[model samples]
Structures are given as C-alpha cells and as structure tokens.
Target chain A: MEVKNTKAYEVVIDSIKDMVFKRELKKGDKLPTERELAENLKVSRTSVREAIRALEIIGLVESKQGAGNYIKDDFATSLFEPLSVMFMLQESSPKDIFQLREVLELECCRLAAKNIKDYEMDRLLAIISEMKETDSEERSSILDKEFHNLITTTSRNKLIINVLNVVSKLIEISIKEYRSQIIDLFKNDRKLVEIHESIYLALRSRDEEKIIKAMEKHYTLIKQSVKM
Target chain B: MEVKNTKAYEVVIDSIKDMVFKRELKKGDKLPTERELAENLKVSRTSVREAIRALEIIGLVESKQGAGNYIKDDFATSLFEPLSVMFMLQESSPKDIFQLREVLELECCRLAAKNIKDYEMDRLLAIISEMKETDSEERSSILDKEFHNLITTTSRNKLIINVLNVVSKLIEISIKEYRSQIIDLFKNDRKLVEIHESIYLALRSRDEEKIIKAMEKHYTLIKQSVKM
Candidate 1:
C-alpha cells in the first residue's frame, strides 16, 4: 500500500484482511472508501478499488449501492463463489469428486434421517415419485441433484450444508461428463429407482444405521457404474 | 465490460469466467491483453486491468510479469486465499469450526491410519515431542497445527487435505482468540499432550477404530474444555 510492495493491490487486500482477522474490523463494519483507503495505505485509489472489487467477488465485503463497502457474514454465499470457481479450475477425477460427495452425502443421509421435517419428507417422496415417472435421463439427473440437495439441507448443520454444496456440484459435473458411461453401466433404471425408494423409506423410519447403509449402497453403485 | 453495465469491470470478469467455464479458454491458456480485452468488451483499459487483477488474486489466472495472464491449475492454493478471508468474515463459534474440523479430521485420522508411512510416524512422534518440550503456548499451538497438518497430509486425499487446511486455520484463529479462556479451563498441559499421544499411539498401532476413538476423545475434551 505504501508502494513498498510491488504488488500494491495485493498489499491493499492483505491490509483489509489483517484488520478483519485481528478483529479490529468485523462483520457488518463499514470499510473506508476507495480514496480514504488509498490515502491511508499510501497506494493509488485505483489499486484500492481493484482490491475491494476482488474482496467483493469473494464475498468478503459487499457494496450496497451508495452505502460503500461493508464486511459480510454470509458464509455459504461467500463459499459458493469460490466453490464454483474451484469446480472450473480443478479437473478432479470422477472417482475423487464422487468419493468426496459420497462421504458428505452419507453424512447428510444420516442426519436427514434424524432431523428431516415432515414437509421435507413429503417433498422427498414427491421427488422420488417424479423420478420414477420420468423417462428422460436429463430429468432424472435433475431430480437426483435435487434429492441429494434436500438431504443436505435437512442435515441442519450450516457447515455441512455449505461444504456439501460445493462437493455435490463437482459431482454433478462429473456425472454429466460421464453420463453415457453411467447409463450404459446401469441399464435398468428400476434398480436405481429402488435404491432411492430404499433411502426414502430409511429416512421415513428415522433410522440412522439403515439410512447410512442405504445411502452407502446407493453411492457405491454409482461409483461402480461410473468406473472412470 | 461494456459501458452498458454500470460495473464495467464486473462485465470483463464475467466474460473471462464464462469462457473458462465453457472450456473456450483452459488451464495455461493466455488471456487477451488489457488493450485487446478492453477493445473487445468496449470497456476502458483501466476496467479490463482491474478485472484481470481480481482474477489473479482468486487463482483463476496468473500474471507472469511480462508474459501476460494465463489460467492457473493450482486449485488448493486458490481456494486457500478466499477460504482465509471467509474465516475472518464468518465469526464461527468454536463448536461450529471444531465440529467441521472434527468431521474432516476424523476422516483424516481414519485415512492416515490406513496410509501413514513409517517416516510419517517418526515425524508425528517428533512433533508431539516438540509439543511436550515446549512451555510457551505459542510454540505449543504451532506444533499443534503442524501435528494436525501432518495428519491431513497423511490422509492422501487432496480434497480432504485442502478443506482441512482451511478449517484447521480457522480453528487456530478460534483458539488464539479464546486462548485465555481455554488456558483457564485447562491449566494442565499434560492432558493435552496425553490426548495427542493417544492419537499417535493409535496411528502407530494402525487400528482405524482405535485411531478414530482416540481422535474423537481428543476433540471431545477440547470441545468440553472450550464450552463455547
């Protein structure tokens, strides 16, 4: 910021970050304007503006039209931005991404079994029935994502939900990339539908062990089917 | 990046992102120069420059001095930068952060037990001994982070290790923030050392169940002691 650093914008970014980390600046606290930050840090206003823009994109700070920049507390949304970017940048193997999703989704199923609300269970059943009726692979895949999303939402842990959102998105991409192979491996959609039904029944029963076993079998089948 | 958008730089950012995500531009692919991007997007060169800077910070692109910008493939480092910012932005409770770490670290312990090498076992012992010999809280915490870092590294799962790196860093911040309260709750450092020792012994014994039990006990003690 003082121009002592060649990367002036990075210096500005780090200065704000250090203040936040040290608790000098906190969530919802308003930051200095671009000009003020530049003057304070002895860098150009353009550098400060660019640094603030970077922070905004990553969900660290939010710009509310005329209200300037304020520190943000939306962890999930903040995480979602990078999580999306990570999906594009990292070419993870089908196995690696799906395996991670399997672990988190299993936990989701275990928790969903315990914490899912009645309305959520109804929704899950509706989705399953919808899946059973759909002949289109695309439609079924959409419902598959929704089903897993609902399970994660039902887990009731913000941390788990946030992390799983990222992992599951990557798995979605992997599935899409290998759709033909997956369909070829699992020729009978009935077995797939039955697996979902098993998970639904397990959730309805609120049995964690049964839920885990059901969810494990479900993903293990997918893992084997998409043997990339 | 056109002036049609109020945030011209944002348009430029989105354009590049869309290209990368759509696979028009790929890892190590060079981006248009600031002048060319500005012209292509009908945005000012300053806006284009700012957009590229933002992308560089996020690890989506790298500016190699005189070599222009190229897409980056280092997923974990890129994720780490935003993650540290998220840690500051989200004031997670000790329980929230530790719970996430427990989930991931438990997996780490399980995998480490299966995958840890003989040299890693020696290094694990060395770190624990360093912790035992240290009287300073700062030194102990450093060794503690190193110890957990090693466990995650031993897991041999890039996704797990990357995610744990971010979580453990937040936990480090949480511990530092609550250091006084934690020290007051557990004045005896010996118990802390013993817990780590139990984990190391279990890891050395190569019993996954024993490793998980010892690790769970260790985190449970901390969770109880912190009580936040």
Candidate 2:
C-alpha cells in the first residue's frame, strides 16, 4: 500500500521539504530541536522525533552528537543513498539499470554538445588522452569514469547528474561481479579510446545529431563487450 | 567533503544493505534490535540506533514504535524519497526534469511496444478512451498519469519505472504551481487523447521506430505547452 501521505511524521517531513523549497532552510542549515518543532507544529514531541529520525535515515538531515539535526550539505550523495539500499534489495535488475545509464549518458552527450564549456571540453579531451596512455585496467576505468563524469557536468543539469550518479553506482556494483570476464576485452584500450574520441569530436563540433550517433555507438560497443 | 563512505553510521547502513543483497533479510522482515545489532556488528548501541533511524528515513526500514523495525515492502518509493527531497531543494530545473521524463518515456514506449501484454495494451487503450470522454481538468490529469504509468509498467523495467516515478513526482509539483495557466491548454483533451492514441497504436504495431517517433512528438507537445 502507498503510505507516503497519511502519517503524522510525513506532515513534519513535508514541512521541512516545503521549507527547503521556500529557502527558509538550506544545505547545512540547522533544524529546530524536536521539542521546538513539536511546539511550532502543534504535534507531539514523539511524532516530531519520529519525523527527524525518518529524515535522518533518508540523508536529508543528520543528527550530530552534541548538535541538533542539520540539513545535509552533500545532498546529491544523500539523494541516492536510499536508492543504493533499494538496489541491495534487488528491486531492480542490472540490465534495467544499464539501459537507463545508456539513455542518460546519451542525453548527457547531446546536452554537452550544446552547453559544454571550453574548459570542460578540454578536460574531456585530456581524459581521453590519459586513457590512451594508461595500460592499467584500473587507470583506464578511472579515466572512463572521468570521461563520463565530465559529460554529466557539462550537461549543466544537476538533476541529470544526480540521477546518473545513482545509476552509475548501481552499474558499478553489477560490473564488479563480471570484471574478470571483461578484463580481456578491456585490455584493448585503443578501440575504447577511439570511441571516446568520436564522442569528443562530436561535442567539439557542437552537433547534436553527431553527438547522439557517436554516443549510441559508444554505448553499443560497451554493451557488446560487457556480458551481463 | 563527501562523507557518505567514511562515517560510522554508513557502516551500519552497509551491513543492512549486505543483508538485503544476501537475502538474509527480506522485505517485511524484522531487523535485529538496535542493541543486538550493535553487539553483533561491534559498534555502539547508539550507532546502531542511528543506523536504524537513517534506514527508516529512506523507507528501507519502518519503525513501529512498540514492535521494533521491519523491512518495508514498497522499496521503490524508499529509493526515491531522498530524490523527492532533492527536488524540493530545487537542484534541478523543470526543463531538466522534463527532459529526463522525455528520455525515460521514450525508452518506456520502445520497450512497452516490444513487451506489452495484451491486457496491458487494453488498459492503456481504456485510459486513452477515458481521457477522450473526460473534460474535467482533474479527471484528465489523473488519466494522463495513468496513461504514462501504464507505459512505464509495460516497459517491464523496474529500474526505469523507479527513476520515472521520482521524475513524475517532481513534475507534479511543478505542474501544480502553474495549473491555472495550463488548465486552458489542458482543456483541449482531444489533442491529449490523440497523442496517447498515437502511442497506443504504435505499441500495438510493435514497431520500435514508430513508438519512438510517436513518443517524441507527444513529449515535444508537452514541452511546448508547459512553461516550466
């Protein structure tokens, strides 16, 4: 059953949520103590306490040893924390997550082509070059992450970045289990570098169609190389 | 600094996450008591309590004041709880969220076209017909949700469904703020019905290209109509 809207604790959560939206509170801002919140909202202290606990669990708030609860500063990480737990629950499949990654990364390329700052473009090219020189699978994978991350950053869409961060983490867990099988495939970094270059050239050209084609080819290659 | 990985509280979250993955714990299963968890994991009782609190916030675990904590059954909602909060924080623009919804729905249409069950197709057609008959803004909006929801469900991708659920909630909030302005545009339910029919027919055709084109036009119309 859907249980999001009815609980008293939810009322408190909603209040804080509205506060965040209205900018009465922000990242790292302190929330009033349970007793204070209870008095202000005309709810029992216990309910207020429960609401704070729920928010803390979700990473929207944190309770320090001596301090009261405060809004989390690293909201993006917190935003995906519950999602990470849900992954553990096997609520979603690896293939489903990978498909999402492909969609988001493709969009990221299209957006980056339009809005990528020159510095971000330079960073993307630099990471591609670094991947060419790196022989270690470990280093190559790190560059791979950086390359994709640059694209996400260039998208200038925080929501997309946050969504992708969650999807990428899920992908990482699934990929780790099959790393041994893909190690040989990944050893040929030249093809990988070339794919990224195609992406880079498209972004440099600032052509959305080319970006989409290049990214489609990039993910298709990765999809074929990795056996889920 | 990003402290998601380094905190003591995170250890507790990780342990519970591992349990869920290993199937030592299941949905609706009760977790060990806080004291018991602290002793077994060799952490302080307070740490265990904090962990439980955080998990509860994420909807992974629910606290039943008198009965202790049980794993929640609806984990997908939990997965997006923090993300909902992030939306309130305005980390994303309406355009970004709408862009995301477009990408996901396009994939949803493609997959749904390929995998939609006969019953699901019938349900989708029913919703479109219902939209055609309904002129009330409220009823049309509800049918609009059902139409999109059916597409996501028909996609048979739990991960995509979860991601879109979060995005949909964000869109709902933005739409509510501008409901009056768009109510006139939305009063033209015939156009809405026609767009959905296009999607429904494409899904029936089981042609991925037609589905993509139809879904793209559907969202492009929406993107133009919604100022946000």
Each prediction's whole-model lDDT (CA): 0.76, 0.77
| Top-scoring candidate (lDDT) | 2
lDDT tens readout by residue for model 1, A1-228: 345635888878878878877888888889988888888888888788888888876667788899899888455543465555555555555555665676677777876777899999999999999988999988988887788789888987666666666565566677676655657777757777789899999999988888878988887777677653
Clashes of 2: 2
TM-score of candidate 2 against the unseen true structure: 0.87
Per-residue error (Å), model 1, residue B24: 6.4
Residue pairs whose backbone atoms clash in candidate 2: A54-B57, A57-B54
Every model's DockQ, to 2 decimals? Answer: 0.49, 0.57
Model 1 / residue A56 / CA error / Å: 3.1
> Largest TM-score belongs to which candidate?
2
lDDT by residue for model 2 over B130-151, one digit each (tens)?
A: 8878768888777877888888
Interface RMSD of each: 2.2, 2.4
lDDT per residue as tens, model 2, A157-225: 888888887676677776564443455676666777888899999999998888889988876775677
Q: Residue B117, candidate 2: how far off, in angstroms?
A: 1.2
On DockQ, the leading prediction is 2
